[model samples]
Target: MGSVEVPSRHKALVYDSPGKISTKIEEIDTPKPGVGEVLVNLTHTGVCHSDMGVMCNSWAWLPAPTAQGQVGGHEGVGVVASLGPGTENSNVKVGDRVGIKWIASACGNCEPCLVGADANCTSAKISGYYTPGTFQQFALAPAHYVTPIPDSLASDMAAPMLCGGVTVYSALRKSGAKPGDWVVIPGAGGGLGHLALQIGARGMGFRMIGIDMGEKEQLVKDCGAEKFLNLANYSRDDEGTKKLVEDVKAITGGPGVAAVVVCTASNVAYAQGLSFLKFRGTLVCVGVPEGPSVPIATANPAAMLAQELRIVGSAVGNRQDAKETLDMAARGVVKTHFEVQPMDKLTEVFERMDKGKLQGRVVLDLSG
Candidate 1:
C-alpha cells in the first residue's frame, strides 16, 4: 500500500428534502476519521431500493424519517485513504480495500452484538440513514466494522453484495432449508432475489424455483434456478393462487417447497408466498412493503397451526454473512448483473427502478 493525496473537500449526493427524489451534487468538506475509524475513498456504490425508501421517507416503522441533507448509500466499496489517531490496534491500515454496509456501527457491548446479531443492536448507527453514508467520494467508517473486500472480486460487483447479497444470504440461512431442498425465491430477477437465486443454487446446493414475470425467465434460469415461474401468467384471484400452489407442488414432486423466500415489496407476493411452503416449511421475509399495506393473508394462527409453518423477518446481514457472500462472489459461485453509470445519472436509475424496468442492480461510478 502506498500513501495517497487527501482532499480537503469532495463531491456528494445530498438529499434536498425528506420525502422526494430531490438530490443535488454539492462539494462538502471531507471528513477525517476520528479515533477507531478509517476514511474510505469510495470507488463504487450500489443504488439500492432501501436507499429510495430512506430518501422518500416511505416506511413508517423507522425510528424517524431520514433527516434532510443526509447522504444516502450503504453498499460502498473503496480503498482506505487514511487511518485515525487510534494509536494502532484496530488491525486496519491505510490503503487496504474495504466496504461499508447498512449497519455502520453497533455497540459491541450490547446483548445482540455479543451474540453476533449486531444488526439488532440496541444502539446501532445506520449508514446512509442516520450517519454519513457512501454517496460521498470519501466517508468515515468504523475500523472494526468495515469489511475487507477480497482482491479477486471487483469493486462494482462487490458493492451490491455488501447489502443485497449478504441480506438474501442471511435470509436463506435463516430459512433452514438444507441442500437438495426445494427453495423458492419470489421476485427472483431483481437485485436481492437474483443474488439469492445464485447463492442458494450454486453455493448452498439448494434447488431454486424462481418466480417473476415472463421477461425475467432467462435471467432467472441463467442465475442457476432449476425452474422459473412467470407470475404474469397467473391471475391474482383465488383460482390464480390455487394454480400457483399446484405448480409449485408439481415442480417439487407433489409436495410443496421446503421454503419460500419473498424478496419483493409487492403485497401480492407476500399474499401468495405462504401457499408455496410445505408442511413445517419456513417463509423468510426480506423485502418490506411501504406504509400500511395489506398484511400477509396467512398471518392467522389457525393457518400457521394447520401447516406448522414458520415466518421470520430478516434485516440486513451481519459481518460474517458479508464475508461469506463476498467469498462466494470471489469463487465465482455467484455474480451480480449490474451496469456501471456516472453519479449524475442516479435520478434516471431511480425512475427505472420505480417503473419496474431495471433488470438487475446498478452500480454508480463515483470517480466520474
Candidate 2:
C-alpha cells in the first residue's frame, strides 16, 4: 500500500447528507498524500462522543462541517503508507505505527499555537469535523500532527488515546493538582472517564474518585479510583444532596476533592461535579452537553465566592500531551478497554450508542 498503485478506489463511509445522520458505504478514490501530508492504511479508529456531536451538529457556534459525502472518524491507528513533500521535518517515515487525532493540523505560527496551545490555533483543521476523518481503509493526515504510536501498544488500545484519553489528560493538567491531589471523574465507567481514572490516578499520581452507577463499582475501582459514588443512589432533594456532598468530603478527610473533571456530556453531571469539590477547587469541563447552550448549573456566584472555586473548559491536548500519553502506554501505564467492530456495522453501532447500551469504547476495524 505504500507508494504502490494497486487500486484507484477504496471503501469509505460517507455522511452523504448532513442532518440525516445517515451513513453509507461507498467506493471512493484513494487519495494521494499532498505536501506535508501522509496517507495511512488505517487499522483501528476509536469512536468518540464528539463524533456523536458531529453527526448531530451539537455545537452551533461552529459551522456545520459535514457536507454531502463527507467521511467521519478520528482517533485512528495505522501504518504510514505515503508521505507528501516537505514532510521530512515532521520526522515521520514509511511504515511507522502512528495515530491520527482530532486536531488534524495547526498553523504553528498562530499566536495561540506558538504558546503550545495548538488546540486553539485560529487556523486549525480537525479530523472527523473539518476534514475527512479515519473511518476508511486509508486516510490522509498532515505529517506534523499525526501521533507516533508506541511499537509495543496494540492498535485497539492506542486508538482511543487520540481523543478520549488526550482530552482527559489535558483536563487533568488544567485541574492544577499535583501527585497527591484528589480528582473526581463523573461517568467514570464510560470510555473517557474510565481511561481518565487510570491516567489521572495510577499514571499521574492523582487520587481518583469515580462517579457513576452502583453497578460500575468494580470497573471504576479496577481503574484505580479510590472511591465510587453511585449517581443513581444519590438523593434528589437538597438535604440529601448536601448529605451526599458531605460524604464525599468525609471520605476525603473532610475537605472534598481538589478537582472534578466531568467526562459525561450531561449538564447534571457538571452541576453535581461542582458540589464534590473543596475550597479553591477546580472544575474542568471536558464533555459537551447536547442541545441548546445551557449554562453550567452549579455556577452560582455565592457558592463560587465561598469556595473560591474555578471552572475551566478544556478542548484537547497538544502534541506534547499526545507524546507523553503514548509514552505512558508504551510503559504499560495506561490501558484501553475496547470492542472492535467492522466498518460496515457503524450505523448499528451508532444506534446502540444513542441508546446508551455500548460500554467502554468502540474501535472500528477499518481493514475488515
Candidate 3:
C-alpha cells in the first residue's frame, strides 16, 4: 500500500485551559508517522470521563499535569492513511480501518509489557496526555499496537468500545466470575457500567445486578441487568450503606454476589464494593476516583480474613483484549448507547459529562 493524499494541516480540539472545562478548535500541522508507525485518519472519537480528568489535572496518580493545547481523547477510530518506514511488511496497510486506545504505545521490552500488561508499561505513552491524542483529524499509532476495528462494525459505534468496552471487558475477565454466577456492577447506567452489564450478562452469561440513580433503572435493565438498585433510594450514611448491602445480599439469595465490579468513580461505590461480594468473592476496581485518593473504608483486615475476599485493580485492556472486545461488538454481543456530536461540541459534551447528565457515551464526528 502507498501513501494517500496527506494534508499539511488539520483541525484538532485542544484543551485551551488545562485546569478547567474548556476546549478550542485549532488547525494544527499534521504529523507524519515515525518508523514502525501508521498515521490514522480519524473520523470519530469518544469523549471519556478520563479525558475530563486529564484536562482538569485531577488525577493525582498521573505523573504530571496536562499541558495546554493538548489534544484530549483516547478512543479514536479511523483508517490507516499512511505507513512509515519498517511498517512496509506490517499487517496494517493504508485504508485499513483501526482504532487507537488509552495506552498509545508501550515499550515492548518493559517488565509490564513482557508480562502482557501494557497498561502498566513502565514507559507507556498515554494518549490525550503528554503524547498527542485522538481528538484530531489524524493521529499516529505503532503499527504493531493499533487495534484493528472489525469490518462489520461502524466507526461511530466502534469509537466508545475502544476504551469503555475494552476496559469493562478486561475488568470482567479479572472478576473471577463464571457463567451463571451473580455479578454486580456499580454505576451500571454510565458509559462503562452499561457495557459491563451487557458483556457480563449476554457475552459471559453472568446474572448481572446494576446499581445507579433511579432515572437509569430502565436503561440498566435494558443493558441486561437482572436487578437494578437505585442509588437515590439509599442515603449516603453508614446505616444506608448497610441497607444497600443487605439488599444486594438478599437479591443474591442471602449469599452475596460472586463478584462486584466497581465501574463508577465514586469513592462510596468502592467503600461498599467489598461488602457485596460473597465468601471468596472478588472485587475488581476499574474506575479511577478523582481528587485526593481515599482508602476503601470497608476493606478492614478482620473482614478481609473472615470472608477471604480478593480485591484487584484493572486498567484498560491490552492489544488482544481490544481485539476480543471489538469482535464482541462485531457479533452484536455488546453495543454502546451513544449520540454523535460534531467536533465543536466538545466543550458542551464535557460540561454535561462532568455533571453526570450523560445517559451513555458520546462520540464526536471529526468531519467538521
Candidate 4:
C-alpha cells in the first residue's frame, strides 16, 4: 500500500472528570504508531454502555475509575493510515480496514494468552480506559491485535460487532446449547441482545426466546426470535419473577430452557435468569449491573445442588471470536440495527441511552 500523509493534531472527545457528565471536543496531538503498532484513521465508532460505565465509574472490577481526559470508545472501524517501524513483519499494511476492540493489547506471555483467553490476560490494556481509545479520528493499535474488518461488512455495521456482537457470540458459545435447543436471551432488543437473538437463531440454529420491553417486540421477532416476552407486562415483585419463570416453562414445554443468556444490566434479570434454565442447564452472564443491585438468586449452595446449574461470566471475545462474528455478518446471519450520527451528537445519544430509549446500537461518524 502507498504511504498516506498524517496530521499532527486531530479532534477527539475527552472526559473532563470521569464519573461526572463532563466532556469536551478538543483538538489533541495525533498519535504516531510505535514498533508493532499501526495508525488507524477511524471513520466510525459505536457508542457502548461500557463506555458510559467507564465515564461514570460504575464498574467495581475496573482497576480504577477512568482517569480525566481519557478518550473513551472501543468499538471502532477504520483504515490503516500509516504503519510504524517494525510493523512490516506483522503483515498488516497501510490501507487495510481494521477494527479496535475492548481489549487493546494483552501480554502474550500471560497464562490467559497462552490459553487463547487474551480478554482475561493479567496485564491486558483496555482501549478507551487504561490506554488511548478510538473516539478520536486517529488512534494507534497493536498490529497483531486489531481485527481485520471483512470487506463485505460496512464500517457502521462492523463497529458494534467488534464489541457487542463478539461479546454475545462468546456468551452463546459458552452457553453449551446445541442446535434445536431452546436458548433464552433476556434484554433481547438492545444492542447486544438483538445480535445474540440473530446469532442464536440464524447462525447456530437454536430456537430463541427473547425477553425485553414491549416496544422491542417487533424488532426481537424480526431478528428470528421464536418467542418474545415483554418484561413491561410483568411486575417486579416475587410474583413477577415467578411469572417470568412460568412463561419460560410454558414456552419450552415445562422442561425449561436449555440455556439462559442474561444480556441486560438489570439485576432483576439476573435474579430470575437461573430459574428459566433446565436442570443441569447453564446461565451465561454477559451484562454487568452497577451500584446496589442484589446478587444473583441462585448463588447459594442449595440452588446449585438441586439444579446443577452452571453460571459463567464472559468478557469481550478474543480475536478468533471477532473473525467468526464478522464472517457471520458477511454471510447475513447477523446484522446490527444502528443509526449513524455525527460525533458532536454523542452526548445527546448518551442521554437517550440512559433513558433506555435506544432501540439498537448508535454508530458515530468520526469523519464528521
Candidate 5:
C-alpha cells in the first residue's frame, strides 16, 4: 500500500435517533490514522446482532463507554490502505489482509493480557462499541491488535469470523467436552449459534444437538448438528420442558449432554439448558439478556448443588482465538452462511434480524 491523500469526506451510516429505528447516510470527514494506527479500506463487515441491540439501545449490562451512536459493525475485513506515523515499528505493514475485531486494542501489560486474555485487559477498546467501528468504507485500526486474516479466505466470509465466529469458537472450546462428547447448542440457527454448531461438531468432533425452531431443523442439521430440537413446538409447561430434556438424554444415551451453551438471550433457554446437563455438567452462558441482571426463573440452586453443575459466562474472544477462527474459515472447515446486503437496506436488515427471521448471517457490503 502507498500513501494517497485522504479525501475530506466519505459516506457513513449514522444511527441518528434513539428509538423508531433511524439510520442516515451522510457525508462525514474521512478520519486520519492516529499514531500506531493503520487505515483500512473496509470491503466487508458483518452485521452482528449486538450492533442491532446498540442501535436500538436494548443492550444492557454494557458500560456506558461501550454504548453505540459512534459507529457499528465490528467484524471488518479489508486491505490496509494507510498507516500512521510510528506504526511501521510494529511488524504489521500496509496492504496486509487484516481484520478488525470486537476488541480494537488492549494494553498488553495488563495481568489478564499477560496471561493471553486480551479481552479482559484493563485498558481495552472494542470496535463498533468502544471505538468507531468498520461500518464505513475506510476505518482506522490499531496495528498491534489487528488480526492477520489469511490471504486464501474471502473478505465477505472473513468478516464474521472476526467477532461472531471467534466468540462462539472460544466458548465451544471451553466446554471441556472432548471428541464424541455431546454438547447442546441452543439458538443454533442464528449467526453465533450456527457458527458454534459447525465448529463444535465438525471442527472439534463433538456430537452436537442443535435447539432452535422447527423450521431450522434442516439448516441446523446441514451445519453438522447431530440432533435438532424445535423450541417453537414445545411449550413451557412441565411436561414440555421435561420432555425436551428427556429427548436430549435419550439422544445422548441417558447421561445427558456433557455441556450446554445457551446462545440466546432468553432466560428460559438458560434455565432449561441446566436441566439437560448431566451431573457435573457445565452450563455456559453467552447471551446478554435484554434488560438487566436477574436470576433465571427456572434455575434451582438446590438442583445445581446436588448435581455439582458448573455455570460459566463468556464474552468475546481474544486475538489468538480470532486467528484460529480465521484459520478455520480459511481452511474451509468452517463455512460461513451469509448474504451480502447493500448499505442502504441495512436498516431493514436490522429490523428483520430483531424479529428473529433471518436464518443466516447478514453481511453489509460497505462499498455499496
Candidate 6:
C-alpha cells in the first residue's frame, strides 16, 4: 500500500481524571491500522461540548464513566497516512484528506445502519469514549466510514462540521419545518446553534429565531437569525415562560413557530420548547443535558395532545448527512465561527464551554 513516513510515537491529549476537567499531554506508541481501517495523521480536531460531557461523566444517558487516560475528541480532520488490509477497494487512500466523526465505526449489518441511523447502530463505536479518539496525532478510523474533506474546505474549517454541523442539519431535517417556516433554536449563538441558524436559513430555507444571551445577539443575527431573543430577559418562572411564548407567537403571526429545535443542554430550554411550537409542530431535541437527566417540564400528555406535537431526539448525523453538510460548507451556504488553539489549551477551552463563554467552536491544532 502507499504510505507516509510515520513515527513510532505521537503526542496525545488524554483525560487524566474522568468526571473532571483534567487533561495531560503524553507521547504514546502509534498503532498500525487493522482490517478495513486507515491510520490518519490528524492535523486538526474540534473540541466539542460532548467531549466535556464525556470527560466530566455528566451525561447520564451514557453507558458508563469515561476511563482515565482516554484521548477525547471526535471532530478530527487529517490525511490518510496508510491503509490496512482489505482496503484496496475503499474510497479513501493514502494522502487523501478525511474526517472522523462521533461514531468512529458502525456495523453495516445493524438495523439502524441499514436505515441510515448510524448513530443508533447497535455496534457503533463512539470516538472519545471507549474507543481511541482523535485528540492525538495518529488515530484509526474505518476506511469506509471516514468523511471525505472537500478540496475547497480547509482542514481546520472542516473539523467542527463533522460533528456540530451535521448534527444540527440532521436535527433540522427532523424538525419537519418546510421552507419559509419559522423555527426556533434555543442556543442560537453556540457552536451547534450558529451552524443550525446558517443551515436553516441559507441551506434549508427556514426562517430562524435565535434565543441566547444579550451578548450573542449580534452573532445570532449575523448567522441569519431573523430575530434574537435574550434569554436573560426572561426569568425562569411560569410568568416568564408565558411571556416568551406570547412573544414567539407575536413574532410568527398567530399560533407559533413550525418547530423548536432546542440546541442547549439547559433543561429550561427543553421545558420551554413545547410552548413555542404551533399545532402539529415538532420539538427536535439535539443537545444532551448533563448531570442527572430530568424530564421536560412541559412534556405532559395533555400538552402533547393539545397540539399534536411531536418530540424526537437526534444524535450525530449519518454518513449521508455528513456529506450533505460538507457540501453546504463547500458551497459557502454555511460557515463555522471558530478560533484555533494549541492542544494544551483544551482544559481552558472546556472550562469556557462549561461556563457558556464560547462564541462558536474551537478547533485544536494537534500539530503541537
After superposition on all CA atoms, what RMSD does each candidate show versus the true structure? Answer: 1.1, 2.0, 1.1, 1.1, 1.8, 1.2
Candidate 5: worst 10 consecutive residues by lDDT? 61-70
lDDT of 2 at 303: 90
lDDT of 6 by residue, 146-188 (tens): 9999999999999999999999999999999999999999999
- Candidate 5: misplaced stretches above 4 Å? 1-5, 65-69
Residue pairs in steric clash, candidate 3? none
The local distance difference test score of each candidate is 0.90, 0.84, 0.94, 0.91, 0.83, 0.94
lDDT of 2: 0.84
lDDT of 5 by residue, 1-368 (tens): 55444667877777766544567677778888889989888888998887777776676666663343567778898888788889877878777878898788898999989988898788888777657788878888888888998988999999988888999988887788788999999899988888999999879999999999887788899998988988887888888889898999999889888999888877778768888888888888887767666785556788879988888877788888998888999898898889999888888888887788888698888876
Candidate 3 stretches with Cα past 4 Å from truth are: 1-3
Model 6 — which ten-residue stretch has the worst lDDT? 1-10
Q: Please provide, for model 4 over 198-246, each residue's C-alpha lDDT reduced to its tens digit, 9 standing for 90 to 100.
A: 9999999999999999999999999989999998889999998898889
- lDDT (10s digit) by residue, model 3, range 28-81: 999999999999999999999999999999999998889989998999998899
TM-score of 6: 0.98
Residue-wise C-alpha lDDT for candidate 2, range 224-320, written one tens digit per residue: 9998888677777676677778878888998889999999888777767788888899999898887777777778899999999999889889999
Q: How many residue pairs clash in each candidate?
A: 0, 0, 0, 0, 0, 0
Candidate 2 global TM-score = 0.94
TM-score of each: 0.98, 0.94, 0.98, 0.98, 0.95, 0.98
Pairs of residues clashing in candidate 6: none
Model 2 residue 22 lDDT? 69
